[model samples]
Target: MNEIAVGAHAPDFTLTTDSGDVLSLAACRGRKLVLYFYPKAGTSGCTVEAHDFNRLKADFDAAETRVVGISPDPDKALAKFRLKQGLTFDLAGDETHAMLEAYGVWGEKSMYGHKYMGVERTTVLIDRDGKIARIWPKVKVAGHADEVLAAAQAL
Candidate 1:
């Protein structure tokens, strides 16, 4: 599949969320959606990002936006992470990395001179019509959720 690009249709997906509920992107159509891809649950960067987004949940709700996080972690791990972090948003379990690939966030990564495959932190803002509003590739954790919320509010 061609890489998802700005102004293109956001790819639809269905994944089991931390709450054991199956969430489909199609079901979220007609609402602004924040699809954030992270490497894992409970990690420092991921936790900070999720916590920030969670803290601003009301802001996003006021703007009529929905936030969904994606990671390769299993449902059990996601549940623990959510509970540990007090995150109120949905954390989708992308065990197969299928949705990650669809969003082009899963690929080769390197750290400490060791190359391996992992998720490249990214955030995609989908508009009401399920179109890509903005794509933040290789995102920096700090202040990212705020930026995304600003874009969603603008939308």
Candidate 2:
């Protein structure tokens, strides 16, 4: 996978949202974006991360930044997860892992001494011009939304 870097143009993608509607990165031009990738829909870490972003959705909006979460889960699972968690922001379904791989977040991972291919928890901050402003790879959930919000506000 090609690693993305700051100042590089972000890879554009179109994916299905939890709402069953299509969302494209190209549509976000002229607006900053917080594109976060998670491994699974209903897992604990993923849930906490999603909720943190949800809690800060208004702040992101105020900063003129749109926050979207993506995972390999299907639209049905994504929708159910959103409904269960009451998340108002977009949660995209990347069932093909195409977006994940494009962002270099899909690769080898290890848990309990076992290795497998999976999506890495990552957050990419795209500037209004669609260039990568910052990337949080292997993100930790605690206080993470605040950090991303700070970056977005700075942009």
TM-scores for the candidates: 0.97, 0.98
lDDT of 2 by residue, 83-133 (tens): 999999999988788889999999999999999999889999999999999
- Give the poorly placed runs of model 2, Cα more than 4 Å off: none
Model 1 lDDT at residue 106 = 85
Model 1: colliding residue pairs:
none
Q: For model 2, state the Cα shift of residue 9 in Å.
A: 0.4
Q: By lDDT, who's the top model here?
A: 2
Worst 10 residues of 1 by lDDT: 1-10
lDDT of each: 0.91, 0.93
